[model samples]
Target: MKFLIAIALLSLSSCAVHHHHHYPDAPQTSAEPEYGNTDELYADEQDYVDDDEEPDSPAVAYPEDMPEEEAEPTTHQPEYPQYEPEETRTANQPKVPSVLQNCDVENFETGWIVAKCGSAELFVQTGPAARGSYYELSNFAATYATMVTNQETAYWGKRSAISVNGARGESTEYQFRAMKPGLFGGGTVDKDGEIIAHGIFTTAKTQHGKAGMLCLTYGSADKASCQRYFNALGKDLKELGRKNGPVMVGGVALRSEGKCHFLRPRELACSNGSLTWQGGSRQALENLVETTIAKWTDDHGIAGFYNPHLVTKCTIAGQTSTCHEVRFQGVMSTPAEIRHATLLEHQSLAVMCTYSTQESAPPPCTKFFGKS
Candidate 1:
């Protein structure tokens, strides 16, 4: 009985020790993974990493003061409008006349041709003549009548008479009489009743008191058939006047009686008035004249003859007082001096002439021309 009981106690004790060792219920720890070599372990651990399970990874905390990175912005481009060039006119273009070419001539005569078309008046003559004698014969009967006849014939012609007078001798004679292809006119019978070809061309009076002769030779013999011929002559004469060729003035003088005033191109003996001349000292005047001549030669242009005698005339206060005249003469000068002389003459006239009644004031010289 004692041996059996002892055996049972030993068996019981062994069984209890075996059961405790095999069924231990305490927590277990996993082995540390090698540096980068636990693919299976890491993948399996992924399942235990979530679903409210405490993470096994090391804690990573961000700083409260650190700034966040900013995203890059997209770029954009802009477009602009295109520009174009403008048109311009060239300098060499010619200007055409407005009037028709058909109705040009009005009348034709010996040594004279009268033409009217548009706003132009053309009087063509042949030689130099006394101003009074030329005007008396030509202005009334030949030029005036021809102009009137031409206007009457044309459908829409407005006429102005440009008187052309010529004398038998002088540069005009060589220019007009020598050339027969222009307008022609005969002076009225003189006291002797002889018909003579009067002076022949148109005249362009220069600022220097010289006259330019304009000649027109292309025209018809019978005044009635010379319409086209007259027109051509008129056009040519207008162009010539604009060109203003050089003129040789033999002399010039101015005279006035009351309101009647006359400008004389050739020096003539004056029956009345005293004379006063102003320009510069004799030596200075001579120098200016030489200078003007030199410039004219260089430019191949004409120089003006300033005949104070032809521009101004003043009556003396006394009843028998002679008319006062002034004169300035120069042979050569620069173009600038020529221009200056022209301007000076124009201004001088203004100061010398009287138009107003102010006691201490002198009237402007330009006033004598009745306001241009």
Candidate 2:
């Protein structure tokens, strides 16, 4: 029995030795997939231990050639350039009065005074001051004009007259009433005083004249330019008197006393805005146009202005206006004129046609001053 026990013990010892020989270099690690070599396993374990042990200095790999960063761009602006309307004036010229910006235009058929200055039909509205916006220099070719009327003789049907305020000693009695900014005779008397750049006769000063005047408005009246131009044209202007005088309008001679001179028709161009014609009758609203908006009621007639210019060989309502042209012979020193406008008289409203000497008139002012 003792000998049998010794054999069992020997067999157990041999089995234990064999198991140890098979895995002689294997690591005794708690981690799964243990390394085959104990030396390699120790080195890997040391690297992981170093990362946890030193928090301040990490062992991260970095490249040698890393590029530097660029700065972002900035945004800024420069200051310069400012402007004013007065720049249009020159050193030699005296500044004229600026035009009033108080124009409210609706219709010329009512609340107005119409002055039939033998040669021209002028419409004027006094007092009832309105406020408006000022503009830069507008040319004579502009369709509208702002007029400063003298309260005394410049009123309706009194025959245009102006009593010079500063030039009391000179006593320049003007025959025409209204004036655009620039045309003051040759030069001016008081170097600084506003000059009487151009002489305008008030053929009519109706309240509703705002319609026509508003239609002709521009950004600037440019009195300086008008004065320069008037001096260049060199036409003789006088306060039309009761006496008879000869004025050459066309090739034919026309009778006049005030001898009111007109601006060069060609220069009368440039407009800031335009008017829309609200239809009415030519004959029905004719009289009403003298005093009110042309609404076709039983008592009123269509208020239509005689075309300031005479147009021949033109068509209206698809027919020639030359046939409708009426020439007055006997009326002494009366204002006769022509127009190139078409009227839809059958309706309740009469629309005024757009007319200006600035360019080729739509129908063209073929005839002017009632001349053949």
* lDDT (10s digit) by residue, model 2, range 68-88: 223112111131111111122
Clash counts for the predictions, in order: 48, 58
Give the Cα-based TM-score of candidate 2 against the true structure. Answer: 0.19
Point out where model 2 deviates above 4 Å: 1-137, 140-143, 148-284, 288-323, 326-342, 347-372
The weakest ten consecutive residues by lDDT in model 2 span 17-26
lDDT against the true structure, each candidate: 0.21, 0.19
Winning model by lDDT: 1
In candidate 2, residue 116 scores what lDDT? Answer: 27
